[model samples]
Target: MARHHTVRALLVGGPMYDSLYDRLPAFERATGLHVDVVDRLPHPELNARVKREFESGAADFDLISTHTKYAPSQATWLSPLDAELGAEIDDFLPQPRELSRIDGALLQVPRYLDVRLLYYRRDLLGGSSVTVPRTWDALIEAATTLTRPGIYGFLFPGRDSGLFGTFYELLVSAGGHLFDANLRPAFDDAAGVWAADRLAELHDRRGLTPRELPAWHYDEVSASFRRGEAAMVCDWPGSHHLYKARATCDVADRVGLALLPSGPAGIRAAYSGCHSFAIPRTARNRAGAVELLRDLTSTAAQLGEARRGAIPVRASALAQIRAEAAADPAEAHRWELLTRTQEAMIIPPRFAAYPECEDAIWHAVQRAMTGVVSPQAAVREGAQHIVALLARERLSPQPNTV
Candidate 1:
């Protein structure tokens, strides 16, 4: 694994990733692999840079940050890590341990993870008779009990990717799957119908959530929890720093994090992915790239990442994090919440058409949420739309950009 060449890296911003960003020089000194970090851009620019530079046939960086869902679509331009991986990957959390491959080629190593979790108002729940719901049925009971004059019980994503992920997770937790082994849509059956019914039930609840959830902005989804407008919410760990800030969040000290409530099938929800390190196939420093990835995603690195609010990718890092956060109850709760969520994780479908598929599915979920149609009816028609869309896509395959 020893390498002398410098590894040109382009990483994105995350509290945990900051450790790497701050200590690139030390990494080079210790490993003999100098890293020239390119501009540490915001997520959108970073993603665009990876695509644009690689597609332009200019391999400027050796190690580029990647994600599980969308990165698979660009796998052709990335080098496969199959030959380089070994027992080193054994201890990572399942969902974040491996990157999605476009066509059976492993193109990246997972670095850190993010998962959907429930954030509830601890102060409100303590006064009520309800405990955190462990199942969908229980959630309804809890939400109903919590709803009073000024506050709502639960909140979900109103628009954007959050809506899609939440809908997909509910579907999966209720024993429904979007695609079968044949890469064909498989969500039109009874399981799918049952899942939608559960979702619609929540949407139809009178005082349990926002009356005009569809009209609520996406940012308001999390803000509602912090401002005490909603008693419970489903959001990512990256937003934790903000939600727990005393100056910003009214419920800061009273915030409690929990795993997504269990569903009809008894499994909790986990719609998740990771930021990873990938080597472009056109890179001149293959050895250096692999060396850099190994060092960056090491167990120690993950532990350091967790201390700053980034969820770690490795299983062992969980215990390390709990120990480190022993003095901070809230941070310890985060680590515990993370472990529980990771156990419930099951990766979403990994295919190039997923973005379009997600949009199609979100539309149906929105229809149910807005009360235009019943969950059964929304899914029945949603499944039909997905199948038709996939069929059309197959007829005239869209070209890949990167």
Candidate 2:
């Protein structure tokens, strides 16, 4: 086989993940192998594109960005990494390592562990009598009290998987499971209704969020907070650097980090997963892909990303970041909150149809929030759609093994 010198890739591109791409020239210089980014889109778009490419049997890229939750859908076409990348896997945190595996096959190398934490404006909280909210109900109360003409009390991504993830975290925290042991839909119960109603209340009844919220995605929500438009937001670790950078954030000096508030069930839940890289079964440059994967997930690479506020999946990189953070009070406080909240992280059940399931639920939740449908109707209809989806998926042909 002729060896290809240029490795083609499709990657997740945005403020949060793009900084790592800056180091690609260095990889090229050292390895004498070029990294050609064939496509660079935000995660949701990237997921949709990858699905389209794979389904049409046109996944021509050598390597691509993937997520633990979405990996199962692409597992059949993903080349297992365990044989090609050996001891390097040993350096990853157990959760990330396990999340990257499917039926015991290592399918991806994790770039970061993503979990949402509460980001608030300390100045706003300090100026008001409202203390930091510790529960969902209390958060509602605080948000209502803090809301005014210029600023909304809370902000969140209102579309796509970001919206679904917000609802999933709240549903779990309210003691609702997404599915029963048999994999049937189980989110139409009272707890699920409660979760949906809370979002509706924020957007519809009380107007605690922007009127245009239903159209906003992750970047928009985070950007709103940076512009000093929201008092509080739940955001991933990747956005932490932007929140703290005075040059980009209007409220940078007033930023504060904390664990997400608990729900009625007394559980603090965060929808979480690992962002990773994987080689395609159709890769034209398999050797080059492996080398690039190693270079991208190396300790130094992870450390650089960690410094920019991404949570490193490599154990050594995490420890080094922690040690460095200990000297800075603000960074230390941020790490402390993240450490204490690990137990509260909620990873979704992996399945090939998971993205479709998210689509159904988020659209339902959005309809409810926008007052196009009642909360009860939304959950009930969403559950019904998922029941049919799962049934159809079960009857469909299983993916081919790599």
Candidate 3:
């Protein structure tokens, strides 16, 4: 039997900060292990710190948790888990696990998955003429119809890479490709232009908000919804729980969640990503570290995590989401909406040039949203920047199709 010991683990994430505080007691009581969590640093900062640890031979953590998006380039620093984890992985959803793999090697063990979802004030639209939109055109029309002074029709985060990435997901769902399999820029097409134009319309023509809307991140926009400042927003599952809290929600029963409107392909679409756990190569207790990961992702651990509304990595834990809902009607409906969004989720391709590409896209989208240039012009400029960066790296663009 594998011996359990005191495993020191470092978790790097934001959503489950409070959940961990409440849930870890049981874990420690059962295993006699103490977990340490480091919150607040962004992904880039954490990556830099990990690199420094390896360079200086000063290891500080045995296990690390991060977003699944970093797997492709960060694989070198991750310990291979296939030999240690065994067959328990068959319980996780297929797409998340597939994305966690690097060259057929398992790089991380996923825990919870997050995808984009639409949140709106049902009180404002519920009894009124407004209806929750299911297509891009319908959404635009609703935004125009429901918008008024002091209240915006639609709002989405557009700040920095978060905003740009969300918009790019819409472009992909709209039948656009960032690059071909050959690593060549393929975003300068009608689908790409349409995506940009749609966003610009929300800002300029639809009266959603001025250029200031894009500056808002997920938190800001979600707060606006809770405060009844925005009529519609595209957000994640966290907002559902955040709004349900008695102290935060102004319209607790009035919040309605739905899938993002379908795109040109008539498909419900959302940008899906996973927050996962990985063992670092510099760990002093490799075997113990792997056990920690297994413990965290096991059916029991995952079920506990899902009890607090986290989308667990393992499929068996999904049943917990339903059971919890059965006990709480509000939670049941919210989770049902989350499950719908999950079905529509698509994981973005991870590449070495992901950060650079994200930067270029952010800048380009900002210029277009501000009316400094047309959508076509902005996308053209963004594509050029991406091409230049790729050429410098002696690589080409390789966009993944969902």
Q: Pick the candidate with the highest lDDT.
A: 2
Q: What is the per-residue lDDT of model 3 for residues 23-86, given as tens digits with 9 covering 90 to 100?
A: 5567668666665554444454555666666668775577877667665556667888888877
Worst 10 residues of 2 by lDDT: 393-402
- Tell me how far the alpha carbon of residue 138 in candidate 1 is from the true structure, in angstroms, after superposition: 3.6
Off by over 4 Å in 1: 1-63, 82-95, 99-105, 144-150, 197-220, 241-243, 282-296, 315-319, 325-337, 392-402
Q: Estimate each model's TM-score.
A: 0.74, 0.96, 0.85
Scored against the true structure, residue 315 in model 1 reaches a CA lDDT of 84
Best TM-score among the predictions, by candidate number: 2
Instruction: Show pairs that collide, candidate 2.
Output: none
lDDT of 1 by residue, 1-402 (tens): 323376778887643246566667777788777787776764545767777887888767788887777675566678878788767667876545545444556677777777878888887675557787777678777888888887887888755456777777877878888777666778777767777666566767454777777655445677777887888888776666667677768888888877787777776768877778788887768788888788788888776666656787788886687777888877767777787887777665666566667767778877877778877787777778878777765421221212
RMSD of candidate 1 to the truth, in angstroms, is 5.8
- Residue-level lDDT for 28 in candidate 2: 91
| Model 3 lDDT, residue 132, Cα | 84
Over 4 Å off, model 3: 1-10, 15-17, 25-34, 42-59, 204-207, 210-212, 323-336, 392-402
- Sort all candidates by lDDT, best to worst: 2, 1, 3
lDDT of 2 by residue, 1-402 (tens): 134998999999887888888889999999899888998899889998998998999878999999988988888889888998788799999888988888788999999998889899898775559888888888888899989998999998899988998899889989999887777889999988999999998889999999889889999999999999999999988888898778879999899877899999998898888899999999999999999999889999999999988899999999999999999998898888888777788887787888888899999989988888988999999999999888788522222222
- True-vs-predicted CA distance for residue 214, candidate 2, Å: 1.2
